[model samples]
Target chain A: MNDHSTPILASQGTPCLLVDEERMERNIARLRDRLRAAEVAFRPHLKTAKSWEVSRLLMTTPQGPATVSTLREAEELAAHGVKDITYAVGISPDKLTRVQKLRAGGIALTILLDSVEQALAVAKASDPKDPIPVLIELDCDGHRSGVKPQDATLLAAIAQALAPRARLEGVLTHAGESYEARGSEALSAAAEQERAAAVMAAETLRAKGWPCPVVSVGSTPTAFSAQSYAGVTEVRAGVFVFFDLVQAGIGICTQDDIALSVLTTVIGHQREKGWTIVDAGWTALSCDRGTATQNVDQGYGLVCDLEGRPITNLIVTIVNQEHGIVAARQGTPRSDQEFPIGTRLRILPSHACATATQHDRYHVIGAGQSDVTAVWPRFTGW
Target chain B: MNDHSTPILASQGTPCLLVDEERMERNIARLRDRLRAAEVAFRPHLKTAKSWEVSRLLMTTPQGPATVSTLREAEELAAHGVKDITYAVGISPDKLTRVQKLRAGGIALTILLDSVEQALAVAKASDPKDPIPVLIELDCDGHRSGVKPQDATLLAAIAQALAPRARLEGVLTHAGESYEARGSEALSAAAEQERAAAVMAAETLRAKGWPCPVVSVGSTPTAFSAQSYAGVTEVRAGVFVFFDLVQAGIGICTQDDIALSVLTTVIGHQREKGWTIVDAGWTALSCDRGTATQNVDQGYGLVCDLEGRPITNLIVTIVNQEHGIVAARQGTPRSDQEFPIGTRLRILPSHACATATQHDRYHVIGAGQSDVTAVWPRFTGW
Candidate 1:
């Protein structure tokens, strides 16, 4: 299905998501190789790519399982023969029916639980004959959802609640705080903190006579920065497959490493203001200003040429629902002659996950080629 | 097809869009009645709703033409028998083929052009037997794309280039700056500026012996704030159909007038920080912080009860891709007990256009009723 040819802009519509297949493969290989070297299982998070084609490339095994943010993704991935899927988000009672359906379909879908209430709910809903597997979410850095590893009483209570109807499979944690890490030192510390927390939670359960086999920990930033994964059995990270500006700004990846971009056409120009209006806007690129807090703020995204090369300091300064205003950064010359009306440009997003969700499909282009090799469909919604 | 019933949260997925049909109808009726009283055509922009059902409700004449942001929308609306449609975004050369196809299908699709280059391109590609119709885009506020109203040379050149092949239908302008209006006085002035600019462009065309019949002027703020239409024929506004927090902050609509919201379920809580995490996040509510600069900054969105009544001072403060953090505004009681896990809440979005674009379908509930009356599908992408 992967066909390579010369770049053809007219065939693909403007403001569509384009993925550099070669760069994407390199990214996958980097992570896959790193995890293999570290003797850790790589469970790629499907929330970022959300494409069956991309998932197939990421999987080491034919029917390998992955982590998904929503039941919709789990159902879609499972239908495509992905077994042992993990619904990473804390399972709400209302979604249990869908979970039951997926589990009954011969898919070993693992649910995440942080509270005793959630554990009891899962236990009540699970079939005793076919007990459900669950991973206890531990909060390492307190950035988002998860229980604290030190809360033994709460952890033991949750594990006991799931005794017969459900199994406490292991412990998992995400160092979302790793996103705030400044440099290599901070990033490594955050990674170690995440690893330690998950291992601590697993050990806590094991000490209580629970068979906690899994110790999963990850975050794109921490996963790449971690020096060791001694006690961690597996690591999960999504955005690494298509690094964005936020990742670049954090010194994790370079702008050239970004595999995804929004292909846009220059519609008009605001000459005096030094703004080149493009068809790609917030709706196309997404309203993710993740780089705003970073050392360098790319208003919306970094502007690049048709060949996916960054156009020096030009960046999208403003965006409406359907219009993006590209301008040169301060001290950079406004190269109006370089980009006139009808010029097609690529914009590297600040957050790959947010930008990718805006489009229904990705136009895959091989490296050194322009023609779309494959059109990968991505499904959205809860 | 509208059915009414009891409020059942479990059947519908969490973080799904919920449209209050009665509120939407009232909003539509108010705008329609206003435009009718003023003796002007009401061509509602379908960019916000993007639903055939909503477009059907907005049209005064059944299967009537409407304004759209993309060719995809025009195709969808045209397929549903909406004949005279206008693709509001500036026409690109690559999209001209699709425009021709839509025109060939018996749909009078009007294109928007602001440059002589574009006019010449359209003219060159046009079928002499059936020329494409275009509206000269006029810059009223310089907030986005358009040729300045006083740029007579450019306007005349475009008209001359479009002569034998493509016909210049009229002139249109949007007062996007009206979004920055502080109060009634500022809003009216912005509206007047939009009216004068569009009329001036139309007059400029007529003076050059060009037949400029249509003079369109609008924006949600200007459409409601304008005192007179004078030389304008039709008004185009979309978000007015589902007023949002940004509209309310601009004093254009009240919170009660917001017809669209994200129905989310509470998944967990951070009691010490007074944060209630919900399933609705940027993917559900959108990453639009439009009201951040407004007088009242409604974080991500205003939180409401299941019946769509705003819970005083509660708002969504932070959001990840799939998790929204709802918190009480300063000085308001932390009421953690009020919103426990599994509790359903409705969140009013900052921008209806941005938020609605995230969902595939909207679960609609009639006013004063809890049960979803219908499920309306909305299409996105260009």
Candidate 2:
């Protein structure tokens, strides 16, 4: 951890995002391998690593069966020749125009909805020649948006509403509550609940003489913990590409598996308060205290050495816009001798997706080396 | 509050940032008038609205006496012909090259430092012919960074380090802790402490026969609440250009004064749970739960109507990466009839600075009108 001679990061600006490519590829491969072994299609969510360069690695093919949170991501991926994509968030009427545009451009873009109102809107927007493929989102664990799996009336109503104008491609559900799962047992249970909910909905649609070809169910924790995909055609997970403290806390990935880190310099110090102020604050690191609810709360982010190894007991305790106060986790004394002014350090993020979006580009550290291999551009906004 | 006929926002995509120009102008004028009446120079921090268009309105002149947190802000403002800028964050050694580059390009760019290590780095990086004008940062309260006003030895040491190579321009301090102040009395006390610390530090340097010309002190709360600026050469404040919920909670600005909002579309609803899901989740509306500690926690943000009026008792309670769960505060029942699918709602930010950085562009509602007159682009990163 004391070996701070990172030539690539040393030359770069103090507050910048660094992606360990070796670790990133390993993380991506781990999830891909798991899903491949499970004999299910892996539709990797591009929301985490919003780079085409990263997306190319995550996708099974250039023309993807990918998942996206935003239409911007769908558009960007489509531009990169990704043809098959699922717009994962609930479809709003206003957003359907962009979805239709993407679909018209020969991208097999899919939209998700859980209500009859949304179904009717999708039906209204669809072309007679090429009806829009839709997914009925099911609420697995009362997490967020979705129709209940057992709501047969609502399920039949939504499918019937979409009948002639739109195509009911499948049913999808996300186990967002799986983030709260502590152990493998809890995670497995959450995954099963998600899978069962998704499959049940798909069955209901099929039983009612409706097309429900795809059964998608996932979340980073649940995807890894799922004992079986069962009837699910494809599995989707976003944060698995760059596992963070939240996923690490969920016991999915360890701190070492976290590919993203903010490269920062020790700007100044408050020796009396044992605070080593760094140039990277909430602006660079993001205000995601995802680990606060976990067993070991990583204040803002866990502090690491330049080589991307954790500095024992050190974390970002406080943050202003551009100033992060790095201190020992348990009020232990830290000194200038350990982290003096101009000392380069890396901070492992609390939430990878949140932190990754803060930066425009990623300085990718070469496979198993300290040298920066390449810089990948990231885009944001709706 | 019920008027939802906004042609501009309706045509535009959901989850875009909207800046009320009339309210913004008023917010900016309030601070400018206050500082001007106090007979002190105002160096408005361009960190809040990082747009050249916005900066032009905030600046007193084309060649600005502006404040910036990052070198990127300084560089961008410089490109817009801003000459006099103070980079307020503590200078890191690696960042000095860029600082020097800016100074060499005819920018009277001032860098701040609180330690001898930084002063030495500044001194080393300084061109003996045109030394970097440096400010010795003083910690007014036990806030973030700075040399303590009472720590004369360290102050003298820093000044001594900059003696021949770097020019000691002045002293600066920001009462970042002022945001924690509740009422006018507490705000005034925080302001006085910030002013006293800067003046006291300037006096200490002067007593040692060192030139300390520019004694700058301010924070949004302190800038407005400070009764006197007797010894201070200039006052610097950001976040006043677009007041937020946090500022409202601090009693510095009323909720009516806030200018920034996130325009989101109601995508779906969890009716039984009284949750209205919106497209603007943490990704669009930042993961900044800044109002959580306030007396009345505004969750993610306070929900407003399309015409930028607050909806009674509504707040965004939970957020996923791309979905926000807006519910009535205190778990009051909110039906789909109240907020149907495709209903465009504007969310007032919890922290303007944090929320504004989440987007790249602002859809500006023209002065006292609903139409978006212009689109202002915002830049971010180190």
Candidate 3:
């Protein structure tokens, strides 16, 4: 193994995910500090930076709980000593055995349930002596799954079904529609709606004498935009640890704040089209046009220099499975001379979660240095 | 270890890739038979199904060569006894060392070079006694990389730069623009252009007495649409093993020919919005919206039943990192009851290359059986 103190990039291969350690730390600190200031417990979602190294730095509370999208992530984190984890996606009956295994391993695992059928499935699958803990999913923005917060009848039925073998923990809401927000005002509105919906669901459950202890609400946009987290016990958000072009486009964070980028090398060029072909294609950068609906359409991703400075007027125009076409934004002269074969560059992703999933590990560049200081493996698949 | 003859999917978890053995074999046979009829050597590109099992079945010539996008793939295939492998991507100076290592391992590795700079870099890196074999990449259609085939001066200059340290082996071109072809007429036109351009480049090289021994031309659409391969020696195409929605939309293959799909389970639903939430999201299915530009806009992917039959009017409308929203197409009535919680479904991807990269292994379903007979691992990364 290479020395951790050595510059990591110097010994690394191209077309690898590069996490700026300082920027990532700063991004984590900003969110943690903000949530702390709001006096709400923060559960950093592990769905974005699926790395133990990054998760270690993200922990504000020692051995604290977190949110995960898949059981695989929960199992990995649990093996690494993370105690509490909420499998954020709605529960499927088939996964009950795996969840039981995770719980048996001493993980304080909580599952998400929105329907009575799911609650019954979990209750039936659970051991009566060791009841499974679950949070009721509330639909805040109707962007995806979940029961509406106002559907008290359905919520009560689900709670009743989980009585002996499962425990009704609280309610969770994700303002995924907040991603469609065009401005701060819209984002703030969506945040408030998300907060209100989760708080309302918790209140309705408590009014009915149900123990709704934890009211969770958040999304990366709402986590930063919410004016208050009043009745919520914990806020959950991912992607802020590595701000992407989508977040930057919506003014969630500046382009400079993006901590994750793909380190690539210029391999060839198409002179007539004024395109500089790079090794980081859709396979490396990902085919996430997250910013396409935003104010500025970052075709594939924003082009940056080796040091992560934005190359003005340059963007990845098109991409194949293994080839990225970098060219001027519009009406700008080509700079083929500036980016000859073997020239290294960094590409800020349109969506951090999408782009990061394409790679197996990250070549972490420490603050104020081009060398890779560390390498962190990330797990993928369900 | 699990028995290879056992039903693989019966014990496997959800949200995993499922490859239909029969369809895949038939697809492979069709391509090989067509190429054989055309009298051109078939060299399948391993960028799609990066599984050694698939490559084994793809070999028309015993222990024959294939094309790869990355050196890592070349190395892996070489280890598995694929002798004459071609690293299809344009060469970078840094990769020359790895190429040399592969060559030393008795693999007749051919690298791609489109510039004089790359030629000189290879020549400088190679040992005088064992020159590196290279193919000059020609720009047939201004879709991506390569030097224009008509530019004989630049080609001659590159050949001169190689000298004794590097050998100019042949010429190759991929009509990636064939992806834009909407109908048979357009596809046939693109194929002709692809064939004509590649042959012209080979003829140009041979006219200059450069001993151009090989001429390769292909793309999935062109491979099937081309009327003749006249002067081409070999044809290369990936994505044929697992046809996808994009290929179907381009009229290359019917949806029935698609062999790869994601096995998912319905976790929850939004009744009012007519949406059924699935466990497979962008992470499992990939974020490739390849069919978005085609005549049919398959949102994330086309939703199919457990038997891999298309569920009429049902499509994955949106996707989160680990959740997919399955809904009815426009003008179709909602059918949430038809797809309840825990109901297993198959999702046909928009692009096989993009989708296959998301999974670590394939759950191989045998011919005419829903049960999986084998599990094959696929490798990824540059």
Residue-level lDDT of model 2, residues A1-382, one tens digit each, is 1354656557777688998888889998999998889899999999999999999999999999899999899989999999999999999887888888898899999999999999999999899789999999999999998999999999999999997989999999999999999999999999999999999988888899987999998899999999988899999998988899999999999888998999898898888887899998889988999999999999889998877779888999898899999998875556344588888889999999999989999998876557877899996887
lDDT of 1 at A58: 86
| Cα lDDT tens digits for candidate 3, A1-382 | 1133244564467789999989998899999999889899999998998888888888765466799999999988988999999999999998999999999999899999899999999999989888999999999998887889999998899999998789989999999999888788999999999999999989999999998999999899999999988898999999999999999988899998999999888899877777888998988998898887877788889998777889887899898988999998766676655577887778999999999999999888878657787789998777
- Report the CAPRI category for model 1: medium
Question: TM per model?
Answer: 0.97, 0.98, 0.97
Query: What is model 2's interface RMSD?
Result: 0.8
Task: Go through the candidates in order and give each one's C-alpha lDDT.
Answer: 0.89, 0.89, 0.88
Clashing pairs in 1: A7-A370
**Looking at every candidate separately, what fraction of the true A–B Cα contacts under 8 Å does it contain?**
0.59, 0.89, 0.82
Clashing pairs in 2: none
For model 2, residues B1-382, the per-residue Cα lDDT tens digits are 1254756657678889999999999988998888788889999999998999999999989899999999999999999899999999999888888999999899999999999988888898888999889999989999899998999999999999997999999999999999889999999999999999999999999999998999999899999999889999999988989999999998888999999999889998888888889998888888888888888899889998887778877999887888999988875546345688988889999999998999999899976446888999997887
lDDT-superior candidate, 1 or 3: 1
Q: Candidate 2: DockQ?
A: 0.88
Q: Candidate 2 — which residues are off by over 4 angstroms?
A: A1-6, A331-337, B1-4, B331-337
By TM-score, the candidates rank as 2, 1, 3
Rank list by lDDT: 2, 1, 3
